[model samples]
Target: MEPEYWDKNPFKATAKAFPPGFHYRPTTLNKTRKFYEFILVDTNSVSIKHFKDPKDPNLNTHSTIQILKVMQPRHYGSNLNQPKKFSAPFDPTRYTYWDYIDAWTNVFWHQNNKYKHSWLIYFKNNTTYNFPNWFLQWWNYFGPIPQIYPEEVQQGFNQFSRMFNNQESRIPADLMYFSSFALSWIFSWQYRYGKIENKFDNSKAALDQVKNWFQVHPEFLKPADPETSLFLNKKSQLAIFLAGSKSKEILAKNLKEVLHLLQQQEEEEKPSKKKVESSDENDDQDDDPFYQNEDDCFGISLEED
Candidate 1:
């Protein structure tokens, strides 16, 4: 049977559309999201082709991996009144927030280069509502940052350090602590909900990093005065808890054993009143000197027989 078509044009073929003997893999930084780079490999010939979009004309089809260098920034207007904008300017500072996003979109969809395709798409699509204001302000304040793997983590730590060091930043210590805790929670959630690989390790590592930071910077753990020591102590306790061992299986087993012991104790504490009542109803009743009223009925008489 012939393949289906619409408007006499073939349907957009994703990585799954490729036939046997051709291995198709779409690479993305975020595993939960769509793939940015689509790579098609011919097992028979061992050749490979990489493309952001399969429909693009300038797809990089080669025998080996292609290394697309970062694009160089174009010169701005000499007078600053008019600015020169390239399709994908290498420097993000040259353009406004929205303009930079537009340029990045162009790079992802139009140009063929080594810029992180997945991240660009993520930032562009995710920040559409905020557009250039909040994003631009943050960018300008923090400057340019690389969105790649280890560098991303390093950049985040550097930013955190900058905020921590700035006395004028006015960011609360508890806020910072909670922010790190929230990140750890997010990583844990991802691992539990989506079962994303390495997420558990990442979450553990993040908690450890936060714990180390607090340990090293004892000042942050201290209160401004002795009056606030209680609050500070509570915060410290929470920090320790977050960084502590998270063995759920062991915890569950311990909880089960405790519950079982409690149940057994409850059963033991429940006296066999029926057996005592049946054995010596008259003798026990008559001996009970304190059992004068109905409220004092203990079934065992306290009077001398």
Candidate 2:
């Protein structure tokens, strides 16, 4: 039996019949003939290849693993411009965010280059960005971040934001904290409705840290009185509570309700039902005017955008 068409030329065999969520752009580097760059449009992942053999023009026969690079969308002519941050160059190996974190832990803590530590070192050398002191402290204290569940990352980010008043340089400790809490909530829910996985060392340590913080600052755990509680909808509540001269205690007081709500939902949800989490991080690219009038099909460009 013949293989599927998508398997034959997954990228642009025909002008209009390529796979969804993927894009192809023709390129030229040196005298390389008929070179093309395949891109995962959604993830901004890119892979470049040169087709030397006419029999294997389509990438279906090519090696899947190559130099993979992350592409940052460039705004050619718009006010939506910001200083460039360090972006990893084309790497021969494909790495996930987890791998990056692991390598970072090994390199930063042990001063060991045993792992694939190039990414972090490259980032540090190329960028002029200043990370927060607290963020650096968190990484130093926890070495490798603990394994986090897919479901709890958002909640962890939110809780962490509340704790730090939505600072741009906030640590992912809260996010990791929620991953640690995953077991408790899963068991708690399973006992009532239905159930959940691994306990990483760093995750456990993070849980302990959060617990110690709460123990020292018990007032944050206290519920705010409804009568005098601030009336806040989504728009202004975060701004008022998480970004200002307000104290951490006051921020925690306001965020207390959200924590309760998350816990309560686990009990409320029926067995086999999955909770859909809306992403809090928004990409400013969509709102940028640069892409508003430009063609989506990006051709080859040797120079930087």
Candidate 3:
């Protein structure tokens, strides 16, 4: 079936295809969409709280991203496989998202590309308003499946984010994923965001002004603001607190831990990527060098613009 424009974007998450985040007709995308996809979910589906500091009076000091947390039943994946140490391992093959659905969902869902493919169809049956646990089960309890290549996921996601920025609505997670899928198509096949070909030998457009395009475009809002979410009530703000200050120290400590884990995932994914390039005969291999490199076409130094 021909996909609708409002559905998937070339750069959307899981653009090319993800081998069903939730498998089985019962659990996979056939049933749930939200938990695998969106942020600021139905409040009841997942519990959310702003980090509080009883030690200090300022309960309101956190990065715009700090307030997110997803809740789940305690016993979901503890019986057989343990949850991977990292909450959101970029290498999904090594990690299971289900150990704690909300935690994992927030990591993937918070970004725009959650469930990038599902939006392509009119999914009236299986759905999720928030993140899904069944998707996480494989990573958490059964041990990792063949992980999706991070380079590919990254490319799909960046394009997904760009496409989500292009949308005018609250950006449900699935839609965020789809828009980038659409954009990824543009990045690879179309050159222009549709079917038209690129006239230049290499169609590299500078990314320095890409965010500027977001600034101008209503559909794509800065990840920083309330404008981007139906959920994040507290608007995004820039703050430079004293480095030695107690509150700043705590936030820094927690965020640093999260970033460190993400760093390790980055490293592991990095090594596999080199092998992917050098090898010539793998059957499951992908076509583009990787989605991330495309950013060079769009990416100017963040310092510049």
Model 1's alpha-carbon lDDT is 0.34
Ten-residue stretch with the least lDDT total in model 1: 119-128
Scanning candidate 3 in windows of ten residues, the lowest lDDT window is 115-124
TM-score of each: 0.23, 0.20, 0.16
lDDT of 3: 0.35
Highest lDDT scorer: 3
lDDT of 3 by residue, 15-107 (tens): 434334322122343223333333223322333333334565444222122212334334235443553443342323222334234333332
Error of 3 at 187 (Å): 23
- Comparing 1 with 3 on TM-score, the higher-scoring candidate is 1
Model 1 TM-score, 2 decimals: 0.23
Ranked by TM-score, top first: 1, 2, 3
Model 2: residues with Cα > 4 Å off, grouped in runs: 1-27, 30-155, 167-207, 210-305
Backbone clash tally for model 1?
Answer: 4
lDDT of 1 by residue, 175-210 (tens): 343234322111111111111223423332243465
